[model samples]
Target: MNTLLTSLPKSTPLPRYATRLLGAALSATAYAVCLPWDLRNRAETAGAINETSPVTALGVTFLSLSLLSLAAYFGIRDRLSWTLLVVAAPPATLLYASLSSHPTQDANAWPVAWAFFTLVLGAGVLVAGSVARQFGPRAR
Candidate 1:
């Protein structure tokens, strides 16, 4: 099991373009899912009906699944996947917004979340550059 776990990253190597496109798609999906939730939350906070619709629940479920998938995909590698990192950004942004808007019992936790988000975004940029370098023309 340990050997299989160690070899997982080597088993799934995606191309640069594919990675970028997938990342963009995933990010867009995350944004789409979160937007409605955000709007609903705002409406509720303004004393509107606080109802849990099935669609909202499903959207949240999808968001959770995407986050989990991203973590698992990126966790296996020494070098993170830029696509997965991009996928992580929206949810992280939502987390930041949540933390900022309502200070919970543990307001101090936001900094750690912020740091993690920064790290993921930074790693995405670095890995993207590395992937881009591989696209250069080869010598004869």
Candidate 2:
């Protein structure tokens, strides 16, 4: 058994950035697919939902994804930069909520909010990864 194990090549783990990127992509895709399904399900079973209901669901999903990503980020060998990425979730969520909410806002604003959230989240992740590469513990 020891001889066979030694003969096999060691599996290499993915880099921190690659994993983070993947997690973000998956989470975004899940959100996209689940949101409409959730809305439809709610409407069919519970009647018309309040304006804030969808938003609240979205927030919960986002928070769950963020926490999962953070947990994955912690497993990486280089954690300094990934910390920034995980830490941005709360503020980003608040910004998303504020921008997407208005008593008088129309349905048109929903698409805009989705786009804005996607862009901001992507940019933040990229920046965090870059900063981690440049100034993280590995740099020293």
lDDT tens digits by residue: candidate 1, 1-140: 44323333344555444544565567656746644533233333565534333346677667655555554443442244443455566656655665466424423566787778657654654454345334322211
Cα lDDT of model 2 by residue, 96-117, tens digit: 5544454443355655766676
For each candidate, what is the lDDT?
0.50, 0.46
Single out the weakest 10-residue window by summed lDDT for candidate 1: 131-140
Which candidate ranks first by lDDT, i.e. highest?
Answer: 1
The true-versus-predicted C-alpha distance at residue 76 of model 1, in Å, is 4.3
Residue 106 of model 2 has an lDDT of 38
Candidate 2 accuracy as lDDT = 0.46
Residue 53, candidate 2: C-alpha displacement in angstroms: 1.6
Predict model 1's lDDT versus the native.
Answer: 0.50
Clashes (N, CA, C under 3 Å) per candidate: 0, 0
Top TM-score prediction, candidate number: 1
